[model samples]
Target: MTYFVKYLPVTTGNSTRLYTDGRDYCADLYEDLRSAKKFVFLTGLHFMAEFGLIRTGKPSDAVATLAQVLRQTGERGVQVFLLVNQFWRDESEVITGGHPIRAKIMKAGELYGYLPETLKLFDSLKGLKNVHCRTDIHPNSDIFATHHQKTVVIDDRVAFLGGIDLTYLDGDRWDTSEHTARHRHVDRTQKFWHDVHLRLQGPAVEFVRDNFLQRWNHGSLHTIRKKSLNSYEAWSQHIGEDPRHVAVEATQDRRPPALPPFAQKSVLSYTYPADGEEPAAPTVQIVRSMPRKDNWHRQKPTWNTNRSDEWEHSCKEAYLIGIRSANKYIYLENQWVADEDIWAELAAAARRNKNNPDFRIILMVPYEGLFAAGLGSNQELFIGTEMEDVIKASRSPATFGMYALHQHDRRSNVQGQIYIHSKVLIIDDAWSLIGSANAGGISLEGVRSGRDEPDTELSAIIHDKAFASAFRSKVWSEHLGVPVGPTYDVHDADRFRGLANKPGGKLRFFPGYDNIKRGVPTWFPESLQESRDPLRIDFAKQSRIIPSLSRDLLASGLPPTLVRAAFTARVVPSVPPGWRCWYRWHCQLHYDPTEPSGRDPRRAPVYLKLRSLKYDRDEVWNYSDQDSVYIGKLSAERINAETTTAVLGVIRCRVKILPLDEGPNDPGPSMVLQFECMFLNDRFARGNHPDFVRR
Candidate 1:
C-alpha cells in the first residue's frame, strides 16, 4: 500500500512533526543533521556562507549551523552529498534589484569580503574527505533559469520542500515588540515574509533523498557509489559485506520496509509489477532544467522518442489542468504577471462564476519591475507591455480588479512596494502550487525559440485542504492588508452577491482598476504617442530628444550639480533622417546602442532605430529582424566608402537638428525604449498595427 503525507501548518489531518518559524526551522534543520548517522543529502537555490541571521546577531548562524552539522555527520562517518544552484556562485551580486535594504547588505558584504569567504566555504566542503558539494547551472537560460527546488534528506528518513530558499531573509520575522525597534535592521514591528514548508517521512523521504543524490551525482566532480557492506572487503571482515553497512553507529533493527530504489514505499509492504503500479504512489516528482549538463544532478535518461505519445505524456504540461480545476477561488503571487493565456483563463473563470459568483481571484505582484533599478536594463518595459496586453484582453467590462502590493517605510515615508518574488498558486482553497517556474512561455511550454525543446519544470500539486486553506488565507491576508486570521470565507455567499452587483462585478472594474489595467507606457509623458514616421516632429520633443541630450550632457561634465541639472532638464534630440525613416517604417527603435535593448535580434529587430528616441519607455518594445526599417537588414552588402561619404554629406547639409522637450516630468536621462507589436491572423502584420496609426 502507498501512503500520502502532506505537511502544512494549520491544515486539518496533516502531520505536524516539524513546525517552526524561519529561525526555528533553520535551528531544527541543524539539529536534525547533527543527529543523523548514515547519509545526508541537501539541495537549494542558494546556500550562503556565514552571515549574521537577520534580526539577530548570531553571525552566520545558518551557515555555521550547516557546517557544524556537516562536521558532526562526517565524524560519525556518514556520506554527505550537497547540491546548490550555480547561480549562487556570484555571491557579491544581488539576484534581483529594487530593494535598497538588500542593496545595503550586498554592499556591506562586498566591503567585508563576505563573497570570497562564502565561495571558500563551499570549496572547503567539496574538498572534505567525506563530504561532496556540487553546484549546477541550467542550460535552458542564464540567470532566468535556475535549479530552484530546496530539499534535504537525512539517512533517507526525513525530507523537506517549499518556497523557502536557504537565505537569511526567509528565516527572519518582525519582533513586534517595541524593545527590538531600536535595532535599525532588527525591528520586530514589521512582519517577516510568510511562507510554507513541508517535512515528510516514510517512502516519500526516499524520493527527496534520490533527488538530491541525482543532482549531486550529476554535478559532483568525484564519482561515488552506494557502498554495500558485503561488497567492502574491509567491512566484510566486520559485518560480512551486507549491502547495508554501518558507517558509524550500529544499524537499527527497526527497518520500515525495503523496496527497489525506484519503487515507491508506503505503510504496507506491497510490490507492484515492474512495469505497472496502480494509483501511482502519492509521489512528489522533482524536475529541474539546468544550463550545464555536468553541474551536479544526474540527468534522467532521455525518453525513447520511438513512442512519441508516451514521451509527450511524460513531459509536464503547463498548469492548465490546475487552473481549470479551481473551484472556489484562485490566489496567485508571482514575480511577474505577463502571461496572456493565464490572464485570459482567470477572466473566463471570473466571468463564468465557476465558483460561487462571489468567488475571489487575488493576484499579488511586485508594484514595480524587479529589473527597474539595477544592472540590467529595465525589463519592466517588456514585461509591462505584455501585462498591458493581457489586462486589456482579459478586462471583463463586467467586474474584475487586479491589485499590486508594495513595501513601504513609515519612518522615511519610503515605500518598498511589495516585490512579488514568490511563485505560488492556491486554487479554491483546495490545491496549492509552489515552485521556481514563472508565468511565461519558457516556463509554461518550456520551449524557447532557439532551443531544442521545452524542458521540465518542477511543481507539486497539493490536494490537502488544510495546506490549501492555510496558504490561501496567508496570501489573501497579505494582499488585502488584513491581519492573519480566518475572517473571510473564499466561497461565502455574501461575497459572491457583492461581487455580482458591482459595475461589472468582481469580474469587472473596481475604482483603481484603470491603473492596473493599463500597461506601462511604451513612451514617456503619456502625451507623446509612438510614431512610425521617425521624422514626425512634436512640440513636447522632451521624450524624443532628452535621451540624446542627457547622454551628451553626462559626457560634458562630471560635476554633481551639472549632472543633476542635465537629468532634470529632460532634454532630448530631434529625430535624424535615418532614425526618422526607421521609426516611421518600424514604429520603435533604441536611441542608444549601449543601453539595454529588450528585443532580441533573433526574435524582434524591427524597432532597432527607436533606440535613438529614448524616454521613460518600457524595455520590451523592439523591431523584428524581418522589419524593413532595420538599417542592418537594409545593408546586406556594405556600401563602398565613396557611397557612404556621399550619403553622409548630403544628410548633414539637409537637416539641422535641435533638442526637444525639457520638462519636470521628463523622467530624467536614463530613458528606456518600449514597443508594441500587433499580430493578425497568427502572423505579425505591421501595416495594421495600432502603434503605426499614431505615427
Candidate 2:
C-alpha cells in the first residue's frame, strides 16, 4: 500500500521563515515577484484586481498595484500561472423558499463572465504574455468543492503558503497583528486581518510546484463576456471587436479541454532557472490532499507515473497523527473547525495522559465570520459548541481552552474586532503544518454523506524542533507581546491560568467573541490578576487545596451560620433606596488533620441564590465555587439592566455555605457569610448582549 497518496519525503537543507501578519507579508510578496526571473505560480479561492500591495510599518514597505506588477512581470518574460476557484458561490443541495435568490446568484456568476464580474477587479489584466489564467472546479472534487489553496511559488526556489485572500481593490489588510483602526493609509478604510503565511525554500517547493501543475493540467480555461469587459475597461482602447476579449456567444457551449496523461508522478527537484539560487532550509516535508483520478477519462489513473487507481489525501492523515502523537500540547488556528474525527482524536489524547495536568489543547478561531448564513459558518459554530461540551464532560474540564484574538482600536484603546484566518496546527513544538486545510467537514471530504468529495487542500509539514520552537515564539510575541526567546518557550500552563483570572494586562486572555456576549468569563485563569491585582487573591485552580482553618472563627460576636439571619436592602435599614443594594461575602478556608469535619481533601461548597423583587426569578443554593466563597461589593448597578432578560427591578441575591461532611451522624456546622471588600459599582456596557439561558 502507498503510504503517501500525495506526500513527498522530507526535503532537507531548506530554510524557512515565518511572516507575523498580512501587512508585511503582502508587501514582501510584491517585492519577491519583482525579483522573480523565471516563473511565479499563484493560486487561490478568489481574486481581487485592486487588491495590491500595502505600506507595511517598515521603511522598506513597497506601494504598488498588484495587477500592474503582474503585468510588468509577464512583460519581463516571467511565467505567471494564476488559478482560482470557479467564479461563483455554490448553491445548497436542498433548495427551499429562496429559489429566486439562488437563481440570481447563478445569473450573477454567468453575467460576470469567465474571469470576473466574476470578481470586481479581475478584468484589467486580460492581455499579457507569459501570464496565464484559469478557473478550476478541482476536476476530481465535488462540484460544490472549491480550490481553496493559497500558495505563491517564485521561480520554484521559494514558496508562500497560508490562509490569505487577494480580493480587495482597497488595502483593508495592512495592519500588523497589532490590528488597529487606520485613518487613511492604503485605502480609505482599515481592516483588522490577523493571519499567518510561510516562506518555504528547498525540496518542499518542488512538491508545491507539482501540486500547481496537477491542477493546471486538468483545470478549465475561462472566457470573459465582451460587453462587461468593455464597459469596465473603456480607456484609450480599441474601438472595434477585441481578440483578447471573448463574449458569452463566443464561449457558449464550450467544454473544458481534456487532461493529458501525466501519471501521479511528483518532482522532488527541478532545474533551477537561469538566475536561480539554491533554496535554503534545514528540512521540510510537503503534504497535500489531492485525488488521483483520470480527469480525461483515460483507462489508467495517471499518465506519467505507474501509480493509478489511488488517491492522495495526506492532509487529514497528517493532522490526525499529529494530534494523536501530541504528548505535551497542541495549538491550532483555523478560520473554522467542524471535523468530528479530529475532535475524537483530541479527546482520546487527553484521556491517555490522565497523569499530566499540563497536557492540554489550545485553539484560536475568529470571533465571527462575514458569511454567517453560509455552511462554513454554521458548521464552525456547531463544532465549537460540541468541542466545549466534550471537554467539560470529561474527567478534567480544564484540559482544554479556546481563545480569540482581540485588537483594540489603535488610537483609542477601545475593544474592536480582529479576524483570525490562518490554518495552522502545531504539536508539542516538534511538528507543525501551515496551509489552507481547516478542520471542517467541507475541507475533509466535503459532504461527508459521500454525495460530494472534499475540497482541494494543501499544506507543508516540518518536524524540525528548532523551526517549530522559533515559529511558536514568533507567533506568541505577536499575540501575547512575549519576548522572542531562544528555545520554544510558551507560557506555563499554571501561570497562564493564573493570569487569565486577573483584571488587566498587556496580554490578557480573551474568551472567543461569541462566548463573551453569552456572559462567559474571560481568561478564567485564576492567577496573574490582570497585571493590576493589587490585592492578590489567588485564583489558580490549585488554590482550591489550601488549609481550611482560616475560616475557623472571628473575635467579634457575629452570626455563626452560613446565611445572615437578617439582611437589609440599603446601607440604612430605615430607608429602602430603590436604586442600588450591595451584598458582600468573604472566606479563607483552612483544613486541619486533627479536625474531623474538615479532613476531606476536596474543596468546600460556596452557594448562591438570586431573586428579583417582582418574583420574576428565584433560585436556591446555586454552586458558585468550592474552595472559598465571596461576592464583592456586588450591587444592582453592577449588572446590566436592559440587557438581561430577568425581571425589571432591583435584584435581590443571597450567599450560603453548605455544612461540611464529618463523622457518622455529625455534620460540621455552617458559618455566616462575611464581606471583606466592596465591589466597584458600574454598569456592564458591552456592545452585543445575548439572553442568558437558564440551565
lDDT of each: 0.37, 0.49
Candidate with best TM-score = 2
lDDT of 2 by residue, 350-452 (tens): 7776677667676766544322212211222234335654464334645666655545563654453455677888877777888888775556555423323
Provide the global lDDT of candidate 1 against the true structure: 0.37
Model 2 alpha-carbon drift over 4 Å, by segment: 1-8, 56-63, 89-121, 138-144, 169-171, 183-191, 226-282, 291-311, 369-376, 388-397, 410-415, 484-490, 493-695
> lDDT tens string, model 1, 1-695?
11111111111222323222244456556777777877777776556543222334455444454555576577677777666554233322232222222333333222122223334446555545677655555454222344656777777667766555554332222122111222223231232343445666654354455555444445322221222434443433333333212221112122222222444334233222122222222223333333324322234422111222211111122244456565566667665454456666765666556335545666554433333211111223233333333344443322234444433345544322333455567666655566555554334433333322232344444545566666655544434434454434633312322332122111211112322344321122223335434345442322321101122322434211110111111112334323321111223321222322111223323222222123423221232111111122112112221121101100000112222433222322222222221111111111211111111
The prediction achieving the highest lDDT against the true structure is 2
Off by over 4 Å in 1: 1-24, 51-55, 58-65, 87-118, 124-127, 141-144, 168-196, 219-298, 301-318, 354-356, 372-399, 409-415, 441-447, 450-457, 484-695
Please give the lDDT score for candidate 2: 0.49
Model 1, C-alpha of 351: deviation from truth (Å):
4.0
Report how far residue 547 has shifted in candidate 2, in Å.
41
